[model samples]
Target: MPSVHFAPIFQRHLPVQSLEPQGRDLSECLYALFQTYPSLKHYLLDDQNRIRQHVAVFINNQALKSRTNWNIPLNDNDQIYIMQALSGG
Candidate 1:
């Protein structure tokens, strides 16, 4: 089982908590997360199912390269973190 964690900022819109879901990759993990919290789907992805510009996903500290290919394999102990991409002037 892999663990999924959302940044503190997301607590404003939904419950702030961590989840351990069974997923071979990011896509499966997200699907399971959305199933548990449907509202998150809109916040995380756009109409094309692409990751929202302001959002970033990292698997074990490595950012995902392809939004379309969420099939990036994961280990049983892997940790996935989701957070807002920061921008500054």
Candidate 2:
């Protein structure tokens, strides 16, 4: 099963712990998380079921390119990190 971790900022709103869930893709994996943390569903995704603009998702240190369609493949030992995106001029 792949593991999902939230950044410290997000942890303030919920438990700051690692999550292990079963899924073949990123969306399904995150959906599993949503099942556990219902509030997180709104924080991470928009009404369209797409990743929010202020959020960033990384798979093994590489940031995901597709925000709307999270079909990235996952491995049993993969690590997924969800964090708030930092932006500046």
Q: What tens digits encode model 2's per-residue C-alpha lDDT throughout 23-88?
A: 998988988888978999999889988899999999999999988878888999999998999999
Model 1 residue-pair collision total: 0
Q: Which runs of model 2 end up more than 4 angstroms from their true locations?
A: none
Model 1 C-alpha RMSD vs. true structure (Å) is 1.3
Error (Å) of candidate 1 at residue 1 is: 0.7
TM-score of 2: 0.91
Q: List the residue pairs that clash in candidate 2.
A: none
The lDDT of model 2 is: 0.88
How many residue pairs collide in each prediction? 0, 0
The residue pairs in collision within model 1 are: none
Candidate 1 accuracy as TM-score: 0.91
Instruction: Give lDDT per model, in order.
Output: 0.86, 0.88
TM-score of each model, paired residue for residue: 0.91, 0.91
